[model samples]
Target: MELQKTMQRSLRSEIQKRLKENGYTLSKLSELSGIGTGHLSEMLNSSPSRAITVNQLDAMATAFGHAPGWLYELYPEECLSEGKISRPRLVPYLVRCAEIGRKDCIKAVVSNLLENPKNISILFSVAEQLFQSGKQKESVFFYELVIDNEKDSYSDQFVMSQYRLFRAVQGTNTEENWKAVIRFDSYWKRLPENVQLDALLQLANVCFMMYRWKDVEKYADELRNLATIVYENELLRRTSPKANDLLKTERHLVVYYGQGFLLKAAALKKQRLYEEAKQYIQGYADLGWFEILDETGQQEVEKFRVWAKINSYTLDMMLGNYEILPECITFLEDHPGEIFPALVTIMECANKYGFCIDEVLERFSEYTSYTEDDLNGLSASRHFRFRYQKAIYELQRERFNIGINETLRSLALADKMNHYQDFKQCVSLFEEHRHHASNSQIIAYNKIIEGGTQTNESSVTLVSSSFGIL
Candidate 1:
């Protein structure tokens, strides 16, 4: 087959590259591998196909300082996709390929490994190990293998794989999160207590990005209740003082509680329930979670703490406590680009209650690379919201010239992107500020909003995306 010939050529190329890297020649490889000079040359260099066997591959692998199955992974799918290869012989090669970022080889070997349903456990183990190693792309590959294999089953591994896969892909801006969201909502009550806790936390986090504040609050409460149960169970299981290591052992629960507090605060903040949101924030700080966390956890809690405070800053606007808003943004500016979730949260709050945010916008411009076009997927919508709020703040500051310009920019953006509500919102802003604008500019803005004028959509396609009304 043509595929087999291509595989052969790839192997020969790899052998030559490795030989040069290893300072080996044809004679040296033959001497070290105990393969004849003619056969080795043919296998590694010949154009036409010569059969490559496991024994021959093993010999080359031994000589090349690789695992016995390394060479086997270089072959194309035509040679490996069928169940001809034993699972035992294929798993190590596939795992090595996965670890080394050899995605094509992984694809080839998966079919061979997946020929038997019993191999699912081994596959899941590899996926979990890869995930723990922070090789999420490869982990998702193997986790999906398990998902594809399990089909309709609801076994423990299946559920865990589903959870892990969802968590892994949450921020990738794929449509998969919506499916995962639906699944978690339907199955939360039936899940294990710990899984319920994880699912709820994950739902809250994902729904926050989706701008689903009410759902976020609901999931956060469920997450809090589950964390409480786990904490109680941990206490009951241990009597001695050493058992009091709950703080160290149950670190995720600590994060869960912190996250729950912030989400609950945000929801209440959105509803203008500043007093209740403040109560939750004060309750969270009173528990001293800030002291017990590791460096990463400490930083995360502090960021969320600031994030909630920023929301409260807006909620407390009527009470004249909004002055701290600038200080909170300054704190964020000082930290640089460490917690992106905090950035998203800040932008969301700014868009909803943004006032006098010129300083914050300048800070974001100087301190962040988020404005680059490369940020067009997961964080693209957030970036647009950031710009949107900056415009609102301009209007708030009574910078009529800049506000009109921003309104024009926003209107042009909304129309190009087919943002119906945003175009209307921009029109409303223009009407409010029409008294301050020149008649010509106002007419131009109205025409754009009415779809009576042509504007370049590509101009704003990469400018930003995704905003909702305050």
Candidate 2:
């Protein structure tokens, strides 16, 4: 980045030194070099960056007994006297400096080149290198330069610029991400088969983040189609000497289709299409969905597989397949994302069956303890459910006042979140547990329920669950 002007010889000084050494007058030198005397004088008198045109440079270097490209090659960086830098020489240094983790060098190059609008290609290349090295945020400025200034729509750089822009915004769950996908999908369909498949998998993620379930299925089907073609061609390439090429890998298909399966399974479950949902899980298991994640995707495939399995168990539970409960508990314990529904289900089933309610409560506590920190996507219903687990824990342990207080807390949170499902569940827990609850607990619960649950907590009442079900 630091170039010493004092130690470096100026092109004007070099030309004068060569002229004196050769004992050639300006007119004689210009005549021999075939450059006009006026232009030759300007070349020697002007600064290095603007010394001469390429043809005149070649002519002068050759007449001075140096190689044709020798003069320009001698001075590659900025010419401070002329305030002009060489694009060809400066561009590579910027890229290499970034590669070796030299931020100061890149800053220096960018400061000089950013003044010239045409250095956008260098900007884009350096951006791509930064992106590959996991510096996506840092690479954003370079992508913006090409995207904002370059007008060519059909070029690869334009397509990549849009794709990278989509990558940058998709995780924030912003409206800009939706717009990015629209821009990305417009040209994504026309890309090469391999390139299109890569974008297709990412598009599925974008749709998933937006909760566009049907679009997830559509992209999944598209990915399956593209992957099948790649696999079929891979079969063709097997006859060649380079049969073991990494390009033949179709594991991405499994990743995309696995996600698609999960999304479809979830949608079908919502529609009460249990048989169809079960079918999706069967397909997923048939492929050994866990192993298919080896090629990797943006989402954690193993975690996703656990989620899908938990979902399958839910569908089983809804279908009266109570036998799947223990396995479901194991998976819910294993992977804790999307935990609200599972917590509610496990707690209700545990209470109904008189299972190890304390162990279940502990599991609930382990998973739901994260709410105090306000994690991303921590919904109000989930928070309500966490408090519900706390209430049930207290009730099961005979701490009636604390249990009732927890239910009241859940009621307050549910009301604030407008979570009717949690409100109803809280009411039901009150109905089933008021026998052991105290006067203040009963009054508080009744006030929160506000006629949704009317109970006489003054008398001895027995509320029994089937302890033999387990």
Candidate 3:
């Protein structure tokens, strides 16, 4: 009887506490849960509370988001002293089960927690576990629950931020990624303007990734404005060297200006405005920004130069301006070790006008050499361009067999190249010859041509053939 009385009192106290947290008076809770107000008042007022039915306890628990079992087990000491059975403890055990990737265990745990709703921390912990295991969508739902229930909590915002950032890192769609930016932006805006600048910068980075230059420009402009405001403030300017330095970093200005120019150039190029694109590129070049690049940035600038020159050559060739050929060749010769872009330009020039094949072949042979290791140290695309030029030159000189031999040599060289596209082309060419010659014979001949063997049998046959060796 004492055990029963203690359990009743504990249940009444637990119910009242939950009702208070939910902003409900006993009268209001009774109305909400469809329990009689008189019975609730009596339960709360009794020295040892009257026994409530299981169904009544469940109704009150549902209304107030409290676990009925948690309330029932609160008087465990009393139950043990009186030799009465107590309800079980399961929340911690279920949490452990979820940790080991047991889906059934996780489902059972989630179901049990949902029955009580007050175990919000357990729900959040489960969501975090799911998220860490790559269950993004499920994690998102539970995170939403935590946010809705705990709006004033800083930890809730942080968790949502982490989830959104993870999705962004995993390369979510542009719209969704931008939505996250907007969400973070809105939150940051509520802070001081100075505090908001970093968030704006992050949004700009996302815009840059999505190639939304206009949005990048917009956010960059805002950051610049904020920086200026901070800069003009005597107090902030005097005390905040870090902020001042951030404002002055070249990345802030360069990304804003350089990306704007690039986007404009791309738009002009797409519209066949070759002259306009050249004007913009030349404008950027004249600013000396390209010259100011550090080692890695300088390499990037060189790559851009090659890309720009190739496009320019294509345009000039389309216009039948043969004079452009000399300029293109000069550019290629100037960049000796950087053979890919140079070879591309030479081939384009050769294809445009019927240039002297033997002369080009002689020039290419004089200009290039293979190392003992056969590692040309050139990019795969460039190396393949060199091989293609060589093969075409030999073919044009009526040296089909030598061209075939050189093609086979190129296949061997291609094996050591990095670029898959170039490797695929070489493999395809090699495969074409397999139908006419034994694979082993071809491999052996290729080895000789690659300087792996001293045998001149193939060279002798080429010299004797009607297709004369060059």
- Show pairs that collide, candidate 1: none
Candidates in descending lDDT order: 1, 2, 3
Higher lDDT: candidate 1 or 2? 1
Q: Tell me, what's the RMSD of every candidate?
A: 8.4, 16.5, 20.6
lDDT minimum window of 10 residues, candidate 2: 461-470
Every model's TM-score: 0.63, 0.53, 0.34
The local distance difference test score of each candidate is 0.61, 0.60, 0.50
* TM-score comparison, 2 vs 3, better candidate: 2
Q: Write the per-residue lDDT of candidate 1 for residues 337-419, one digit (tens) a residue.
A: 43343444455455556544455556566543443344433354444444465567677778888778767866765554444
Residue 255 of model 1 has an lDDT of 67
Candidate 3's C-alpha runs over 4 A off are 1-284, 289-311, 318-320, 331-340, 357-361, 364-378, 409-441, 444-470
Among all candidates shown, the one with the greatest TM-score: 1
lDDT of 2 by residue, 1-470 (tens): 24665457655677788899999998989888998887876667654324455455557888988864444534334322266555454544444444445566565556666676666677887778777766665666678777877778777787788777666544322244467678778878666666676677667655544456677677767776776666567557767886774462223545544555655565455456779878876555445533323445434444455655666677677676667877777766655654555766556555545555566565566565543224222233345655787688778877887787888878766654334566678778778877877887777766766744322212111111000000
Error of 1 at 141 (Å): 4.0
Clashing pairs in 3: 340-382
